[model samples]
Target: MEEKILTGRLYDVQGFSVQDGPGVRTTAFLKGCPLHCPWCHSPESQAFYKQLSWMSMRCLGVDACKQRCIKACPKNAIELGVTQKDVKTGTDLQLIHVKRDLCDNCGKCADACYVEALYLCGKDYTVDELVNRLLQDKKFYDRSGGGVTISGGEALSQLDFVIAVLKRLKNEGIHTALDTTGYAEWEKIAMTMPYVDLYLYDLKHLNSEKHQAVVGVPNEVILDNALKLAENGKKLQIRIPVIPMFNHDEKNIRDTAQFCKRLGNAVEVVQLLPYHNLGVMKYLRLSDDPVAEATLPNDAYIEKLKRIFEEYGLPVTVH
Candidate 1:
């Protein structure tokens, strides 16, 4: 049988990135996630379709478009000018109506607009295409011990595509890392492990009920994957997003530390990514809800969390 080719959705291919993994690296942001974590930072990555993001601030009004989008839309979804509607509270709500169902993915509207107010979010690329783009940063990779990091809504959602890309990178002598939620099938994780040199594992919550409540999924599978990876001696860096009113309590921190301790020497480090509103604008662009509305933890809260991890003798970094 002939081998099947795999393709994946990518939102961005960032180069010369240092924070994602070791050294200067190329990061591939894959699309289509399974979990709906209420505090998700990248809400635009959730859907498995080509999304049109409208930045009202970037829009140059009706004069720029020549009404191209209004004509192109089949469902009459695109209407020029401000659309006003009454809210449930009996107040008028003004919104730009872009008939989503009428969009044909032609991107004519985006092309017509000069200021780039309307843009598509997802693009499909073959492994070779992505590899070529990644190799452009080879010089940086060589200097920083960085190669490529595949992150996503969830990298495992596109397992086959990721496997092909990772294998190709490994063949080219590039060190690879996977930033995952560890929510996929074990066999899939095992298949990709040989090619992946590092795993940036996300541990959202310790309690099963709380995990489900916050992330829309139980923690059992994720925990199991971590344990399995540790037992197999995979290089792992566990990360937790410090969201207020969620998993920021001392008990949760201590519990996470204990879990890491059980994973033994396989787990190298823990990173606390303080919640930020950097991605809030993306929510508005995609017309999605803002998940990280809570205020970011103060320096003292962060320091206390770091101390909790230090008690386990585990190396921790706050970012």
Candidate 2:
């Protein structure tokens, strides 16, 4: 049997996202990741398979449902429950329970439910499908010098698919940026480098041991790729997500600054992305453990870190 080409699961194609890259960008979030970073913001993007996510806020109580899901479920995954009682009338509001094992991927429950309590996370798309969607925002890309950014669990994990998409975009004269962890093989990085305009390199940690401890992989490969890109004179922007207990200290900051400085003048900027609980709900949806109970860093500490990078004389942005 022939090997199949693994395309990518596109979670969302967000238009006019300014924070992801310079100007206004259309970001295509690819699915699957090798690194299991504790503080990952898009936890849904990690898994390669199609998974279910429920937004509790969007759920309507059982009063409106017709029990279609209970009948549709093959594994008896869907169960009815009395959610609450009316204060005066003493009537019960029912809800549905979904057993993971019983789910047959039929999607009948999601289709039948009137309220959007259930949602599927990932789906496959071809290169043409992705390019056509991105081209819809060409006017904005032209106006703001913004284009498409390929972000993921890690974009490089799907090397051939990403390259195809990027090459297609370049052929159509669209500016392209890649938000990567730089954990890919050097050859794969080099292959995509020609088509990519800017590189958003993530600097997770300077210490190899600590990097492995948090992200479940060694930092050697990532660091090597970063240096190779820098050596090739690629326009690189180093992004460091300042986690409270991880790389928020002065030592790591200084070391990263030095590394960026060693990249010569090609690297013109460093972005300090402060950690947040934005993805906490995702952990519950995936039934996984949360990374840390630590709080977000205060403004004073963030400002202090900014000054530390400013000592390197490179432009720094704190978010």
Q: Which number leads on lDDT?
A: 1
lDDT string for model 2 (75-120, tens) is 7877775386655567666666677766765676677766767777
TM-score of 1: 0.91
Residue pairs clashing, model 2: 62-94
- Please give, for residues 1-319, the per-residue lDDT of candidate 1 as tens digits: 9986678999889888887889999999998888887667777788777788888766544544556556656566677557444443454434356665666656777766667778888999999999999988888888878889999989899988999899899998999999999998899999998999999999988999998887788989999999999999899999999989999999998999999999989877899998887877887777644445888799998999999999999999998
TM-score of each: 0.91, 0.92
Can you give the lDDT of residue 222 in candidate 2? Answer: 89
lDDT of 1 at 103: 62
**Model 2 segments beyond 4 Å from truth?**
1-6, 81-92, 101-106, 288-291
Q: How far is candidate 1 from the true structure (C-alpha RMSD, Å)?
A: 4.9
- Per-candidate RMSD, Å: 4.9, 2.8
Superposed on all Cα atoms, model 2 deviates from the true structure by an RMSD in Å of 2.8
